[model samples]
Target: MVSVQNRRIVFSFLLLIIVVFSSYKADSECDFKAIYNFGDSNSDTGGFWAAFPAQSGPWGMTYFKKPVGRASDGRLIIDFLAESLGMPFLSPYLQSIGSDFRQGANFATLASTVLLPNTSLFVTGVSPFSLAIQLNQMKHFKVKADELNRAGGLHILPPSNVFGKSLYTFYIGQNDFTSNLASTGVDRVKQYLPQVIGQIAGTIKEIHGIGGRTFLVLNLAPVGCYPAILTGYTHNVSDLDQFGCLISVNKAVKYYNALLKKTLSETRTELKNTTIIYLDTHKVLLDLFQHPKSYGMKHGTKACCGYGGRPYNFDQKLFCGNTKVIGNSTVTAKACRDPHNYVSWDGIHATEAANHRISMAILDGSISDPPFTLNNLCRS
Candidate 1:
């Protein structure tokens, strides 16, 4: 027979084991669950270039080991976010060439924008699908996932089962101000910003309506600093960094975010199931610009892949990688020693590594205030 002390020891051991097992199970279930993405090139993994002819070179040489349609060499913001959540990278909607949605999906297109009416960024035959269209695609995905689940096929965890497990990330609004409104003027930014904010809020609400309970909305990065825009225009050198990243543009972004916060607050009050968390990419970008060394970046003022120098920019030939190079013009564009080591990708977009840092920051509960943080919106 066991002694009384031995019996107590056994009971304590059993209780400890139970507690450990419970904690393990909770964490295991939190593995990157479901990822739904909507936005433009910054987060697009290649939806636009899927059908277009291959001419651009710097398109996808870094990550996929070749041009895979994503604007970056490897992944995008959404990809890293998915990874952080312990989920496989979501497939681009156009990558239907041979995709299995059981994992996750992406509806972001290279040139898509948040503008309500939607406008073209360039005349390169890039279709600027609005955010609304992307939302519709997500709805279709939801329907398809349900069908697959009912048919006994592999499927994403249901929105119900995946409620807190799922995360939707948005990286939009830059093109609206840069491609559509900026060329027009800041007045246009001030004029249409309210409508822009409303549409974004409506998009989030729509997602919630369709069982999307958690969202991570990344505000637009500083547009004024894009190498493409900054290098070409003739402006005061003193105000260049602050140019494309105009006070007006940043102001508009702040206003939009403020409205979004209010809208989300009201939304959560009415819809207990839905929650929206705002991530501040704007400040991150600014920090990167002001302090490149801290982020291990070398060139914050110029693109690593474009062609141009001093007082003028001319990357019209698409020279980042090599579908357009004829017999090798010595590869005029420059790539950093290590892309993973750098913060900015190309000259305008954040590299996969940089995005990963930001995503981690969000998870670590670093930025948690209005116009920058969204801790209140995301609750396990």
Candidate 2:
């Protein structure tokens, strides 16, 4: 009934349709357009300097030329996550110094607390932008969108924008309890943690309502294990090596992380477009602490800066860059060699390499169940 030439033409068209369909299906399935981050120094790019200089110094010596305001040697959890996703490193929301937000921005500060009246006072701490404040910023972004539309400018995301096309990430609350312990004691954790955890859940719901569906929530790492706290307090050697964790602080971290996991599970059940995935940073970090050789980390309990004496310095005078005055005598913190290889437990925070590893793990889905790795997040 058909000629040979007509038969060939039909077959060619069928092949073309198959190719086009495959391409389109792939694109539609994995289309992530934006990444919004909120949290503290662990993920902060440069939020510290917005309100204070001391919050962003000495530690930022390796990757950055001087200090770009990060509390670490260079980079943080956010930077690693962006890099893993093949996205640009996000600029700090407070970094008016030099960055283009046409890409993304970090709202994390040094001392940000997740709770209202967040009872802590370390100079240049987390801003009042609590989780609620960060969501307000998103609302403010929408206001900017309206203004732009009125001015004949295109909106970053129009109302018709598809859900699950962006990823919302949070790495907050370490300062809430850490500062509490540093200031008063861990006993107060039981009293205030419930309120803080509730706020976290509320914040996630708000983001989901505001059009965020693909979400990643980083759980608290071992708070008792930070080099700053580790060096500050005298520890039982047996307890330290057995877990490489501080019992008192870690106990609080467990309670908070457990509550956080439950909160995320509830959010997943309630929201349609939203999926709250966890990054067990606490467990992974402890594993890393116990097995430093696997990640090429040599230092665990000591920081790259700060006084190297036993039960390391905590007073402001003996800080990483501060000059100490012992009977009018001055002393400065020490620096380490090859910071790229060292996992900072001190000089205020962890090293860039450490963040990169965590980011890679998170992107690979090793941090969550039914994992959604970085490649998976950006396939389309």
Candidate 3:
């Protein structure tokens, strides 16, 4: 014999409990449902390989045990990030067959530049899928995913609401500097950096307009310290820095980073509600090269999978896992016995060990601007 008020209280309590439990979705700890990634080879899982020729050899030997279209011998930073967030590995948007876009998709490609290349992909070896084109692809993906979900054919596609709740990440524009650094020199490359940064800013805004609220932007790595650049560009005695890195090129890299940080700052102001983070890839890599002991690395600047001997071990004509006919014999650029000891994987990209280090730095909030940790990206 409970009173009327007590009966109402019991009903209200039961109703509230039902509502709370009904909303439980087992979301990520960070509250991010999915991740939409855009970048160049640094994060390219299989875009270029699917769209064009696939890379062979020991590209993914270390971890994946086979060539998975990634330029690295194992996982990239993006892979580690997905693991950290408890999400499935992202598939390439261009990869049509056997792809699962239920978690997210990668739009990055090898040799991809933010700006459209002046020449064809074959001529310059730069990717045709620039940032703008990637954005358009994302727009189309959103609509198609929703349609598939409505049709009950979206088992492989993410829910329509995921596009807005997903984290938008960018690791591009490295080629924008690298491609021009050799031909155009630092001055000319510096002049066009604004355009590169603008393109990235606009891309973020576009994602935001489509309901994206979280973003993680990675700045350029230290190209001057890369074995590829060191081998490609011959520097005089005075041009080398204390660590034997190119002084002039590193100066230009610093300049580009400064401008990039400023642009991200402005973009953050414009998109007040969005969570924009700038991860310092440059600083993290430079420290790894300069202080290898700190990262348990031995061969700081040398490439683990390239031709040439000793100090850098990178050849301009011979890339890692490439084969060429020479003197009636075929020579392949093979990997080292101990890739974990080296920093550079193919003189251009980082080894999986190095990629892990970079991811840890960001997760620990050491190299990220505004100091956001992995567990909470949306926090101020």
Query: Model 3 segments beyond 4 Å from truth?
Result: 1-28, 119-123, 326-330, 376-380
Q: What TM-score does model 1 achieve against the real structure?
A: 0.80
Q: Which ten residues in a row have the lowest lDDT in candidate 2?
A: 155-164
RMSD of 1: 4.4
Whole-structure CA lDDT of model 2: 0.69
Candidate maximizing TM-score: 3
lDDT of each: 0.64, 0.69, 0.86
* Model 3 lDDT tens row, 1-380: 99999999999999999877766533324577788899999999999999996578888989998999898989999998888888778899999898998889999988888987874312377898988889999999998888888888657888987877888899998888888577667777787788889989989888898899989999988888899998887678688887878888888888888888898889899897888989998888898888887878888889999988888888887888888875687888889988888889999999999999899888888888878888564221
- Where does candidate 3 clash, by residue pair? none
Model 2: residues with Cα > 4 Å off, grouped in runs: 1-30, 53-57, 118-126, 154-164, 233-244, 310-316, 345-348
Candidate 1 residue 320 Cα shift, in angstroms, is 3.0
Q: Residue 379 of model 1: what lDDT? A: 26
The digit string of per-residue lDDT tens for model 1 on 227-261 reads 65554333555553342334554555667667766
For each candidate, give its TM-score against the true structure: 0.80, 0.84, 0.90
Ranking by TM-score: 3, 2, 1
